[model samples]
Target: MSRIGKKPVELPSGVEATVSGQTIEVKGPKGTRSFKATDDVTFSVENNAITVTPRGKSKRARQQWGMSRSMVENLVTGVTTGFKKELEINGVGYRATMQGDKVLKLALGYSHDVNFEVPEGVTVTAPKQTEIIVEGIDQQLVGQVAANIREWRAPEPYKGKGIKYKGEYIFRKEGKKK
Candidate 1:
């Protein structure tokens, strides 16, 4: 038996969930999110809780059973408290600034500033010159946005000069002997 699958997801106050066909939708004060399960697993809603059960004892069904339940739980969390990702910039003259809520201007020791356009359903903010915060209801989207920004200048082991996720550790390499 799958431990995660056996546990039902409880809907907190001010939250509602509905299961239709193979899809489950959760609505809360933040927003509404949904997840579609595979045929191997089935979803049911009862008594303010969502349950995911495997169609059969097959390996695939058991796998989907646990994954589908986690997905539904993520949907509930996404629509309630939302998700966030923080990025830190390190290097001489590297900085970030938010131009309203639409654009994020970045200077990573480049000749020209990088103008990152904010996508729909996500908000990017720069609380400090070297700190950036990405917020959104969708966890995947928020993480993707933060990754894309970090890609512009990934931290280098030599000098650690680049953008990286907050609290990320970069292994430093010793310089060549003179």
Candidate 2:
């Protein structure tokens, strides 16, 4: 038996969930999200809670059992509380600014500024010159966008200069002795 699959996902007050076919829809103050599970698992909702159970004792069924439950949990969390990712720019003259609505202008010591296009369902904001905040109802999208932004200027260990996640630790190495 899967530990995570056994626990039912509780629906908070003001939150709603409906199951139809293989699709499960969750609606909350933030937004509404839906997910469709495979036939390997079964989904049921009762007592303001959602549960996932495998149809048979097969490898695939067992795999889908836990995954389907987690996906449903994510949907609830996304619609209710949403998700956020913060980034900190570290290097000299490095900064970020929001251009117009969906464009993010970044200066990372390069000769030209990098323009990052914000995708739909995700909001990118630059609260400060060195800070960037990415928010979205979908947890995967939020994390992916933040990762793409970091990929542009990943922190270098030499001087610990570049863009990094908030509270991320960068290992420092001693420079070569002259």
Candidate 3:
């Protein structure tokens, strides 16, 4: 009865999927990814699509069946098209630039500039010195890299100066009176 679980995942062209024991491997033009299925879940590939089913009628088995299937679908899509996160720097003098391999230099009104290294499989791009783009095949890694970069200069409540996701809302707080 899982809405998402009932939908079969379509396999894209040039992507290969193989199931061995409890492991599922998906390979595509971008890269290869693998995931381990839970004991109570079952999976099969047919007609260029992947389907998942729960092995029992228990609630826990049903819950894990949908979750595991969604995760596997995400992995397949990620390896093929990849994922991306965009961030913007607000406030005067706050900027970012690529320093070197796996390194990003940020200037955010701090005494010392912040340096962050891009993790493997993730790419960071600063197109306008104030706008950043993070891309990768793994959704978790992309989000984590964006969070780490944002932590260097979190948006302030009063001035809203710092790194933030594009289109994200920031609530401004009133400043103290002089």
Higher-scoring candidate on lDDT, 2 or 3 = 2
Which candidate tops lDDT?
2
lDDT tens digits, residue span 21-81, model 2:
8999999999989998999988888999998999999999999999999999999999988
Candidate 3 residue lDDT tens string, 1-178: 8898889889989998999978899999999899998888888999999999898899988998889889998888898999999999999999999987689999989899888988889999999999999999999899999999999889989988889999999999998999
Ranking by TM-score: 2, 1, 3
lDDT value, residue 135 of candidate 3? 95
The residue pairs that clash in candidate 1, if any, are none
| Model 2, CA-based lDDT | 0.94
Model 2 clash pairs are none
Count the clashes in each prediction: 0, 0, 0
Q: State each model's CA lDDT, in order.
A: 0.92, 0.94, 0.91
Residue-level lDDT tens digits of model 1 in 89-168: 99999999999889999999889999999999998999899999999889899999999999999999999999999999
Where does candidate 1 have its weakest 10-residue lDDT segment? 17-26
- Model 2 spans with C-alpha error above 4 angstroms: none
